[model samples]
Target chain A: MSDSDGRRGATRRGFIKGALAAGAGAASAGAAGAEAGDPAITELQPWMRAFGPGVDASPYGLPSEHESHVRRRYVEWLRPDTISAVNFTPIHQLDGIITPNGLCFERHHSGVALIDPGRHRLMINGLVDTPLVFTMEDLKRFPRENRIYFLECAANSGMEWRGPQLNGCQFTHGMIHNLMYTGIPLRHVLDEAGLKPGAKWLLAESADAAAMTRSIPLEKALDDCLLAFAMNGEALRPEQGYPLRLVVPGWEGNMWIKWLRRIEVGDRPWHQREETSKYTDLLGDGRTRRFTFEMDAKSVITSPSPQAPITHGPGPTIITGIAWSGRGTIARVDVTLDGGVNWHTARLSGPSFDKSLHRFYFEFDWDGRPMLLQSRAIDSTGYVQPTKDALRAVRGVSSGYHNNGIQTWAIDSEGRAENVEIS
Target chain B: MSRFRDLAALSLGVILAASAAFAQQGGKLGLGRPASPDELAAWDIDVRPDGLGLPEGRGDVLTGEELYTGLCAACHGDFGEGTGRLPALAGGEGTLTDEFPVKTVGSFWPYLSTVWDYVHRTMPYGNSQSLSDDEVYALTAYILYLNDLVDEDFVLTRENLPAIRLPNEGGFIPDDRAGTELPAFSAEPCMENCKDRVEITARAGALDVTPEAEER
Candidate 1:
């Protein structure tokens, strides 16, 4: 329905009555016989009459018990073992663009490495004027920068490459997190050591047992890379590389090595296992695409999704979600209520950081009809998010990464939603 | 207080202060000490596509098969078929275009350095960085044999590794989405009446692939 539909003739009392009449079993429990305001306001409540615990109850505060459900969840089949496993951040349960450090999605190759800051070291060797090793204290002595960027694993939405399969937005797109990284510009450190004349490539290596590695072009390393030591105003979590991590802005997450220990300057790219056998994108004609970095602009409706179904019987509702791009900031987002039949411009809000998540919302009064909802994002580079069919047309369904297609969620008459693809 | 003891202490303090000043004057910001040659060797295991870092090593196919049976057969399979959800090292030669593309090392990897480096750096599952250089060369040769790329009696060495090439050496190209996909996808999208009608094509609930929510 249009924005003016409900404001024309409906009164506040009338709207509430209409919603309750259509709400069915969704009404509050014992609503059939409860006296108005008796148990809550008219009577004394337990919390008002009791004393609560003081500040020292917790040395470090945690989320309230009621919010225990809001957490990182993993698909059992996706991670055969805890090692070489991943878990999705509960994006649907959050608001705003900054994902809390504790709730960020984690991808580990060899499980979490617990390192003592005093014992940890970062080494830079190969083709340099001087090879150097910095203790964690020495690293902190350098100038630092704070910038927010989204690190998305290439395999995000990989399960949906063939079709809509995952039930919620979290499972399909949870292999991503946006946060502020505090670190020294890799160029500063590289300049201090001094690159040799023939240096053209960099090999980022991790300290985990997997010893994960990826090759990066020297131009990219100097342009916007970071030897990040902190994230979101605190020391990096052990699960998130602890003392140090590499921040490759707008690149695939695998290249942003965690538990980062060494960087080798060279004249050529090192064909590591992560790059050649895994992250490469396979096409329909037996050919592959390597280094398919830079996540395209994409958006998804977090609310009114399968997990967070609308519950107010559709008088006035808020539809909100997230949009981001690796190439640039999100320029605009257009949401559709009737699938692809029409679109409405969504309002972008909160701080808009480049290469970071942007929150958006579309408020409308629902007329209580079944709907097919979808959102499309256009980035600063003028690249419009394509349909799943559009992406499949050129790349074919063989690819398991870079599936940044528009997503559709079908909402039924009873105010329930399901993951679906529209024809 | 002894005058001789005080004089000795003052002279020691002066020397300590001088060395502290000298250590802080290296490189920019005077941070991080020079890495020793031995220190670089401890962590420098990267191998380039052109065989830049291939260490001296030699191993025959028979030796590789025996080592493979002892160390890698549990997860990677005896013939590199891959047991459970672990990755396969061979076969799936022409299925890259099929609906279910079976990406194996032989059929998919573009460089021999990747196979050799992976075995050397992070193989043996839980016990990574434990294999010797010769053992890594043997395991790589065994994988080549599994992929039918090397003869059963072939011996792989550091010198010969550069000449060896995988089947899909030329199968990969750099990302071209900017050139191939950006233009078509950048047009001003339709705002109204774009579709006459919409119908549900597939549903996630119908497939039941979603893991049970309550399961930890």
Candidate 2:
């Protein structure tokens, strides 16, 4: 394939090598020529001659039009209809840890519900000393805190369990987003209505058409859970449960109920459909596993992937991606170039918080050789991300949830990449 | 050491007295009002496995058959076998250990209350919570009958619902991941020569699951 420079008949490896050598020769010549005579200083640019757009052109700003390609995408054949389907975050295009509010992935059981916050009421009953109902204003009166955390669907890399099933990292591992949520701690709200002696579990229910429900242990609800009202510094988007949602840190995304309307304190776990029939992981044996929450340590290289291929000839290349663990903060990430033969500890960039996405980078000079790229993450809990074979050995191929297998990107001689399974 | 222990005991006694005063103040932040019984009844629709929240209703399989054909047959075929991407509700009894298991209700579900609760909460796909109490009961009975769990003449009620046990009731085990999996996976990962040779076992491009990128 021809490169952007229209270098014909040269292989990708040859093109990169030749370009690098030519670049070095040109740089030396340009330095000597600059000492002889200055030229670029005499040129005038159009931006310096013209006035830019004034402020207030857009009261609420948006990403530049050049960034229009960055968007959530869905596979049409994955579901029967869009109402109960899922769309993936554009993780390949993102650099930092925080995913933009609008570009966050969407997974709806019965589509996004447009609830009127004015009419919405949160009811807390069942095994509480006082059954209480709070309006939006009343909810705001309670003490609140801000936290950054990642919400990962249990089925994030589920398609890869049997084998590599999606060509892009966006499809295989993009069912997650990290956000800064502003909300009141659930303990504060639950304490407002005193817990009874027998309270053991909680039923967090949504107000959408599906009325999605899941039973959470009372201890977790009283821990780091939040009744979130805002995300990423602004009111939550409608698709993100505008008025309120539950941020069950480190748990499965489905347990973080959106458009939350009621919380029932219970004496026993509610074997709802989500917990009993759907989310349960079927095993190689004839049994199933329930309440398989908490995503394990996982990582994936975002760029230089199938969707985001290497365009420029190799020089100073930055291999960057994200790593996260539901159990705790990511302790370290190791990147391998030739599959898992040799590894280099990647540099962890940006703020590292518990249960939040951590950005990592491995900067190196590329010599235009093909690579078998993979990243393995280890969390503070000392659990390392397992290989696909290692994971299959334990959980079997029947499990469609919690497939935190190490992903491999096969880079060809053309610097183009594709998803493949390695043994 | 005894003086230090006496001082610590005194401080603990004072803290207990302060907490007692706070408890007497009714744990009130004075934010939300007590919910009326009617409001609680309207939003509290969760059904436990013990049939705690089921409404008073009874429906026979014969009535369920008519209702299933009329209401559920559009997405879930006449025999509870799903059409398109809709979930299949029956006929996957012995397929759990197969290469590609069909985890339908009769085959994988561990509780019958979940079947009734799911229908009452979010069934008919689009028109959720639109079924009457009796209709939900009838649909549950029909689905059970479709899976051969119940006979055609069987009737379902809130009282006898919890007594019905699913075939896979004993198939579920609580998540032992922390105890079973954490130790095995917690070992220090090897850095060099983790494997002798790497081979491409499979390619996702060959599967053709990903959609083609649109021409920019």
Candidate 3:
């Protein structure tokens, strides 16, 4: 709808009531409910259907043919070619905390290299007392652990700092995905090298065509970091570090080098180009900040924000979205109904894990008036998601990375939500 | 003087008693048992900052260049400039200012240890660790040579590899935010009347709706 239409003689309240009365239960959910009532007609298919012949159809396994709209979206301007610097995930269309594997966004410095798992080898060298190379089978012999964490690119939701450039959440917040990872603890492998007294850091390297590498602190390595092999209970997809990747807990996703091949122990930290020139934040001054690794706590109201709009009337409205923290588990999330005025605590739902997305819901009885919506997250460490103005006040828009601005959704009297900038 | 000595001895006894109680609690949880030698041997594969885990191997730049040309040149480029869709593995020194800053091995990596560890562990496009130990050393030597970090005749053996020093060796320090910054801001935050009022400034397109207008 045009901006000028709501300003006409008939207010948005009258217009919404008329539309709802004319099209009772014709929305997306209502249509789905109307189509599938009978649940028990498929038992005869296995014996009757001819598999070798032309008579067969898929039953339990499928990506809905109609879900073509849910495919990955690429930012054409980001990279010169499609293989590298691809766009991130579309969190707007996704409904729960977990991002389905098919729709998980991808970014590859070099095009995805298909690796034969049987032939893959991970080598540990450098300052280690005894360098060792472990085959995939050897890696599996070690004890395994599982943990769910969110991997967010430093550039997630970066474009919004200048303006509300993207209309969908997939484009804005899609550069992040959460999954349960299965792998061996980094400490187990580090222990094998017999770290010397002065050793303080290690470098993880990828065997991709780009040969990506990053320096990790010794403390973090000995902590919860993992030498991940599987994601979300299955072998990682080709786009996501297929054979092996470094699972650096609570850190940036790019640092989790996919197709990992080597680790070198060292007496000091490595200031590789990835850390100093690219990942480092260049502030307002000429001086550049380095090794700024931790991704801060952030949240956004997915529904009632952009991609999903409110078409119902002023009665019981279900407002929902996602919240997460890199430092630790989320403690609380607040939903602002009237802009930033009196705030109401939203109910946080789903399994809460450290560095994992927390789903939240806020139900309100609307009275057919224009409303502004926003969400704020508080992590276990007591760090609050900063307001857009607050972030701009300190860092300014020039720094495009690590933007956790408080997103605002303005709902008109007509029940439509628009991306809005709160001064 | 006797009374003072008695009080001091009594205080010391109380402190020791408290410590014993703490130790007993820790013992119940089985927290401080040193891992068995076998247990340590089973899982300890980590390489430290020093040259600890390096295996016996050696290679020269001449052999490394051949390996690179065969396995990596397709994607990384003959000169390590990186291809159209792949990341450039060379150049990018002091160019963090350019609109499209290219960070490569020569320009940005802070630790020589990382370069060695990364290359040895994972490298080449399709085949991972398919190369022998000598091949990894050769590849490392060739890459260092390409970046002008080392001479063309440089040989990367278990002996000389640790001697190479990276440019940004002192670039990183322990995170100072918790100790140096957070404490200063930990005082009671102003909760009420700190900000008089907030005003609305912008909105997203999909969020705003108008029923009077025909659907697009």
Q: Write the per-residue lDDT of candidate 1 for residues A202-310, one digit (tens) a residue.
A: 9999899989998899999999999999999899999999999999998999999999999999998787888888888888777888888778888898987876677
Docking quality category of candidate 1 according to DockQ thresholds: acceptable
Better of 1 and 3 by DockQ: 1
> What are the per-model DockQ values?
0.40, 0.40, 0.11
Interface RMSD per candidate (angstroms): 8.9, 5.3, 10.4
Report lDDT per candidate: 0.86, 0.87, 0.71
TM-score of 2: 0.90
Error of 1 at B214 (Å): 5.0
Q: Pick the candidate with the highest TM-score.
A: 1
Over the stretch B118-191, how does candidate 1's per-residue lDDT look in tens digits? 88888898899899999999989989999999999999999999899898899999998888899989999999
Model 1, position A343, has a per-residue lDDT of 98
**Per-residue lDDT for A1-423 in model 2, tens only?**
224545555443344455446656666666777776434444576767898779998999998765765889898988899999899998988998999999899999999999999998899999998999999899997667899999999889887889988888889999999999999888877888999999999999999999999999999998899999999989988888879999999889999999999999999999998898778888878678898878889999998788777655567788999999999999999999899998999999999999999999999887788889999999999999989888888778998998898999998765678899887
RMSD of 2: 7.5
Error of 2 at A68 (Å): 0.2
Clashing pairs in 2: none
C-alpha-based local distance difference test score of model 2: 0.87
